[model samples]
Target: MHRKALLTLLKEHHPVTADEKAMTQATIEFVEANPACFERTLLIGHITASALIVSPDRQQVVLIHHRKLDRWLQPGGHADGDPDSRAVAFREAEEETGLTSLKLVSPAILDVDIHPIPARGDVPEHLHYDIRFLFEADPTEPFKLNEEVKDVQWVALNTITTRTNSVSVLRMVQKIN
Candidate 1:
C-alpha cells in the first residue's frame, strides 16, 4: 500500500486511453520523484483512492453529490498516507455511503485520473492522481448520507449517461463486466 506498490500497479496496468496511459506514466514518475506523493503534504498533487461501486446485480451504481465539487462522483477520498489503496477505497466507500457490505470486484486499478482540486482556505489548488477500483455493494443494504456528500443514490446503469455527463462514471460503466 505504499508508493512503490502503486507505482508497480501503474506500470503494469493496460490503460484504455492515451490520457490514461500518460497519466499512468506520470503517476509512476511522480511517485518515484516525490517522496511525499503518498502523503497530502505534496502541495502540487497527491494520490487518492476511489471505488466505482455497483449494485450486487450490476444494474445500478452508487454516486455521491460531492459537497466540494458539486458533482456526482463515485465514492473516494484522499489516502492520507495510507499505502493500501484497496483499503482506502473500501474505507472511503463505507464512510461516504454507510454501506459495509461492499466488496472489491477486483483489486486491479480500473481507472486512473489526474484532476485539479480547486483551492480551499489556505490550501492552494492541487491535482489528485486518483486511482480507482471496481467494487460491488450488497443491493439489500441501505445507505446513509455522510458529510462529504449532499445525497447518495443508486442510479440505473443504463440511465447514468442522462443523469450525469461525467466521463469517469461513463467510462467505468462501460468497463463494468
Candidate 2:
C-alpha cells in the first residue's frame, strides 16, 4: 500500500529543477525495483523523509545541527519502514526541533533528494532517497534536543548557505523564493 502511494506521489510530483527532475525519476525507478525501499536494511540505499520547515512569516527556516553529519541541516531522518513520507517528515520535524505547532504547507512533496551516507559502524555507504515536505511553525517555540542532533536554530532563509552548502538545501530554498 505504501509503495503504491509513493509511486503515485512520484508520478504526480513535478520537480522544479533539472537536477531534481532527474532525482525524482531515479527515486521512482528505485522504488519500483525495491519492495523494501522503506527499510533501512536495504543497504544499497533506502527511502528517507525530511521536513523543510519555514517560519510562519517565511523569513526563517528551522535547521538542526546534526551530531553525526556535524552540519546544520533541515530536520529529517530515515523512514524506518514507514511509507507515509508526509507523516514521517512531520514527525521528524517535531522530534528534532521540539516544535509542536507545525503545519504542513501542502500535501504534495516539497522536494526530492538522493545523497550518499558514509559507511558507519555496521552499515555500508548507501544513498538516501529523500522525500521532503514543507512545513510552517512558530520560530519562537521552545526546543528539546534529542541525542540524534547537537543543536537546533532558526536561520534566515537568505543566509542558509552560511549554515550548510548542501546543494539540496539550496535547491529547496530556491524553490520557496
Per-residue CA lDDT of candidate 1, range 1-177, in tens?
A: 357788888887888878778888888888898878878888999999999899878899999889989989999999998888888889999999999888889879999888889999989999999999999988768888888889888999877876689876687788885
In TM-score terms, candidate 2 sits at 0.97
Candidate 2 lDDT by residue in tens digits, 1-177: 569999999889999989899999999999999999999999999999999999877899888999999998899998999999998899999999899999999999989999999999999999999999999998778899999989999999777888999899988888776
The C-alpha TM-scores of every prediction are: 0.95, 0.97
Name the candidate that leads on lDDT.
2
Worst 10 residues of 2 by lDDT: 168-177
Q: Which residue runs does candidate 2 get wrong by more than 4 Å?
A: none
